[model samples]
Target: IRLRPGYFPFVEPGFELDIHCLICGGKGCSVCKYSGWVELLPCGLVHPNVLRYGNIDPDKWSGFAFGLGLNRLVMMRYGINDIRHFLSGDVRFLYQF
Candidate 1:
């Protein structure tokens, strides 16, 4: 995993997490879109202002956040070629999991 700069109103310092494309094995592939890396999540340290708004004291409290891309994760895990397989409501696809 690696961190890249990002922007989020609720966070002081934000980042995006990227992992080498598992499907491509670091090579260009449809799953990787030829980038050789996959963006799996956005994350960040909690902003002081956001802490205060949540009734927490910024002076002592701190936090971090991460957002996962579920669809991407699934594709990597199962080597799924088409994302629509997840939403197709087909028993054959759903039953695989």
Candidate 2:
């Protein structure tokens, strides 16, 4: 995914977009805290002026991003009942899978 930086009244360099999480195929998951994503950082190329505004050169910088949520999906798929159960290593549940 690609994102562009723009000015927002509240933020110095506002990010208008972010990448989708690979896990759950962006559908959402328990591991992602039901957010369907693991990473929650806003990503984008810093605006040239914004770069200068922060005393950094925009001409020399670029960025890329991706995210995942493995555990949440595992809980959702296996009918784990509770997230803590997975950690307990319960024999009954392990046998079912």
Candidate 3:
């Protein structure tokens, strides 16, 4: 796993979490875009503006947030190369789960 700097609207010092590609075992593959890594989530400290908008004192109540790519995680878990398979509405694909 690795964390890289990233940008997101609701967070300050945002980061993107990535893990070594499971499908190809870090040898590189189309699913990982040949990078040997697949992004799994975005995370960071909550932006002060967001806290202020929520009527929370940012100075006193700092927090963190993250959004997980559940579909992506599942894809990696099952070695599904294409994400469209999950949304295709095909009984063939649905039956496997």
In order, the Cα lDDT scores of the candidates are 0.86, 0.52, 0.92
Q: Spell out the clash pairs found in candidate 1.
A: none
**Shift in Å, residue 23, candidate 3:** 0.5
Candidate 3 RMSD to the real structure: 1.6
Which ten residues in a row are the worst by lDDT in model 1? Answer: 78-87
Instruction: Name the lDDT value of residue 84 in candidate 2.
Output: 77
> Lowest summed lDDT over 10 consecutive residues: which window, candidate 3?
70-79
Clashing pairs in 2: 30-72, 31-72
Name the weakest run of 10 consecutive residues (lDDT summed) in model 2. Answer: 63-72
**Per-candidate total of colliding backbone pairs:** 0, 2, 0
Reference-based lDDT, residue 53, model 3? 96
- Residue-by-residue lDDT tens digits, candidate 3, 1-97: 9999999999999999999989988889988999999989999999999999999999899999998988888988988999899889999998998
Residue 53's lDDT within candidate 2 is 75
Q: Model 2, range 3-86, lDDT digits (tens) per residue? A: 556454434445544344454556765644565444334444444665567676657864333223344356546645355777
* Candidate 1, position 96, lDDT: 82
Residue 88 in model 1: shift from native, Å? 5.5
**Deviation in Å, model 3, residue 75 alpha carbon:** 1.0
